[model samples]
Target: MELTLDDLGVTLSRRRVLDGISVILRPGRVTAILGPNGAGKSTLLRTAAALIAPATGTVRLGDRNVATLDPRERARRIGYLPQNAGVHWNIATSEVVALGRLPHRAPFAAPGQHDLDAVTRAMAATETAHLADRPVNELSGGERARVLLARVLAGEPDWLLADEPLAGLDPRHQFDILDRLQEVARQGRGVAIVLHDLLHAGRVADDVLLLKEGRVLTSGEAAAVMTPDNLRAAFGVEVSVQRNTGGGLVCTPIGRALATA
Candidate 1:
């Protein structure tokens, strides 16, 4: 199964945020959406998660349109974790994650064995098990981010759509989160994440879609789409693409180009 966006055109407050956006998020791999600020990266993730309706075209989950699916069915199949997802309550971390089970629970029913197991596994995957009992507000920003991610993971959805999940994280935690996300994709689920770090995108994503001004500049295999020419075209920066010690590609922006913004 796949989450496919077919020629999507979305408008917010009478202004088009995404236009002619067409991409397929296939199972078993990560697709990173890279773009500058206000390029509609988060908007695209919202569309994929069925949180926003497109003005044109359609979002399909497999052969069925997402708009036609039941709300709980959509929730059970697609997990969306927006950037800086917040917890308003002073509740325990595990409790925060348990909230993800709402879609699975019957009306007025307590969490079942499956729900509990999923929460536990999610906490463990995000390395937040130790913070199980801590109040969500007590954790640092990075730690809170992890807990929120676990909340999404607790749903065990077939597709993950995360917006800037690597933000507010240290370098090690960034790697840790990326590795975990890659592991999620390897488990035969699809992952679509918004990212600003081109290096991390190159290292972790099997495919990449680069957006500029809400339109796709280039899209394909990460290595192919992130060429120096594409970088200059998208970001107006002249960059040097090189191989690191691990043989992964690294991009370095050496100078700004005189291209019009």
Candidate 2:
């Protein structure tokens, strides 16, 4: 599956949050959205996930406009993880992960064997299988994040949109989540993630989209979009972009320096 946003603009009340943003997400690749705080990255993800209606423009999933799809159908096609998701119930982690299957279930029907298989697989993949019986509210912040991620993955949606999925995770878990996303992409699913860590974005994203003030600053392959000039322009910091000895680019912000005469 693929997602294309055509001149998508979103406005709330009287404030414009996203403006003329156009981008394409293709399967078998990871696309990272990077920007400063309050740059509408979350807004874009929400629009793509059909959680919010765009004030203007269209979001096409494959050939059909997403707005035309029924809410249940859309939920089955796109899995979304919000920035700050809270679990209000004292449910077990396994039960919470099982909620992802709701989109596929018939009304008042119980989950079948296949749904149980998916839930188990998702927990195993996220390393949360051992914590399955634990109460969601009792988990640490990072543990809760992974369990939520497992819930999203259990949906088995064609498109996955995640907002700051790594926010509360430690370095090891951060890599684990990114690696899982990469595995998903390799299985030919479209994955778009809102990433705060530029270094992690460079490490995992096949394509990079940089946003500023609700506008696209630059977007393309990671190598092309992550140039020092663009980084300086978007972040206002001097950075050194170099290829790591192990391969791939490393961007080190050397700190603010006066422009040379």
Best by lDDT: 2
What is candidate 1's TM-score against the reference?
A: 0.95
After TM-score superposition, the amount by which residue 227's alpha carbon in candidate 1 deviates from its true location, in angstroms, is 0.5
Instruction: Write model 2 residue lDDT over 1-261, tens digit each, in one string.
Output: 789999999998889999999988888899999888878999999999888899999999999999889989999999999987989998999999999999999988999999999999999989999999999999999999999999999999999999999999999999999999999999999899999877888788888899999999999898998888888877777778877775667777788755777
Where does the lowest 10-residue lDDT sum fall in candidate 1? Answer: 243-252
User: Which one is best on TM-score?
Assistant: 2
Model 1 agreement with the true structure over 1-261: per-residue lDDT tens digits: 888989999999999999998887788989999888888999998988888999998999999999889999899999999987889999999999999889888978999999999999999988999999999999999999999999999998899899999999999989999998999999999999998877788778888899999898888787888889898888878878887787667877788987565
Task: Give TM-scores for every candidate, taking all chains together and pairing residue i with residue i.
Answer: 0.95, 0.96
92: Cα error in model 1, Å: 0.5
- Candidate 1 has an lDDT of 0.90
